[model samples]
Target: MPRFMGFVKMEEGIGAPPQALFDAMDKYIGEQSAQGHFLDGGGLFGTEDAVNFVVRKGETTRVDGPYAEAKEVVGGWALLQYDTLEEAIKGQEEFAELHATYWPECSMVATLRQVADEPPAPAEG
Candidate 1:
């Protein structure tokens, strides 16, 4: 089986999702979880209090957020597994449809990426 990570991105401070969307998601997630596909997932808070430890050259710099420049941010994520990429895509599309049907007023992007199973090769000198 292959694992995929889904990131839901949207504008910061968007209003809460409707109850209908929540209800639909709860039912959908329950079904997927029971089948052992929805491994883990959760929503995240706004970036106002987010912290960043950025490295440039040999120095590390700490940055805190309330990022004025960022128009969109990752709002939630899901860890899932499927037998094939096609199945994963289908599952993700269904999930995205829930939002489209229930929360049409809000714009969002749901990105699905396959998780890397093995570590990458070492960096060249």
Candidate 2:
């Protein structure tokens, strides 16, 4: 099975929603995990608490945010293991559907990236 990292990107300036929204998402994710589609996941706070570090040459400069300037920030993430990309896509579609049905006022984008497997150790001669 291939593993993937799925994340939700929330539009800037949107504050956290009511606990009911979180409860809905948690229930859905919990069901998936029980079915083995979800490995682990959690939500994140708004970007006001973010810090950005830019490294130029060997020097690192840190800037504190109001990441208000960002267009979108990851609001949550999940790890999934699937037999194929199609299965992963279908899973995300279902999740998005849940959001559409339960959190219509929310604006979010969901995306998935495959997790690379670790390489085998070099042969010992």
Candidate 3:
């Protein structure tokens, strides 16, 4: 199965009370898990508190936020496992529908990824 990362972008100033939002998210996770598609998922605080870094020349450029334009900013994400891209897309669509019910203004994006290969065997100590 391949792993996919999905981001749920929240509308500006649309955040709900933390507990309420978390409860809704938990319900969604439980539903997804019951369907065998949920691997892991969670919510995040506002982007200003998250970290973003970039490489420029030989130096690292550190930024304070996983910031983005208001319309495209991500508020939370989930990681899921699926047997095929079609399954992943289906899962993403389900998520979007659920999110729309609870968060009508939000949008979603999903990226498919394969796990990286294991590192070469370490030298004997």
For candidate 1, write residues 2-121 as lDDT tens digits: 999999999999789999999999999999999999999999999999998999998999999989999999999999999999999999999999999999988899999999999999
TM-score of each: 0.96, 0.81, 0.68
Q: Mark the regions of model 1 whose C-alpha exceeds 4 Å error after superposition.
A: none
Q: Count the backbone clashes (under 3 Å) in each candidate.
A: 0, 0, 0
Top TM-score prediction, candidate number: 1
lDDT of 2 by residue, 1-125 (tens): 99999999978666567677678878888888888989988887777777889999999999887775788888889899889999999999888877777778888899999888997799999
Give the best candidate by lDDT: 1
Tens digits of lDDT, candidate 3, 1-125: 67778876655456563455456767878988887778877767777777777788888987886356556566667878788888888777776666556655545554445444476798999
- Compute the lDDT for candidate 1: 0.95
In order, what lDDT does every prediction score? 0.95, 0.85, 0.68
Name the Cα RMSD for model 1.
Answer: 0.8
Off by over 4 Å in 2: 18-20, 119-125
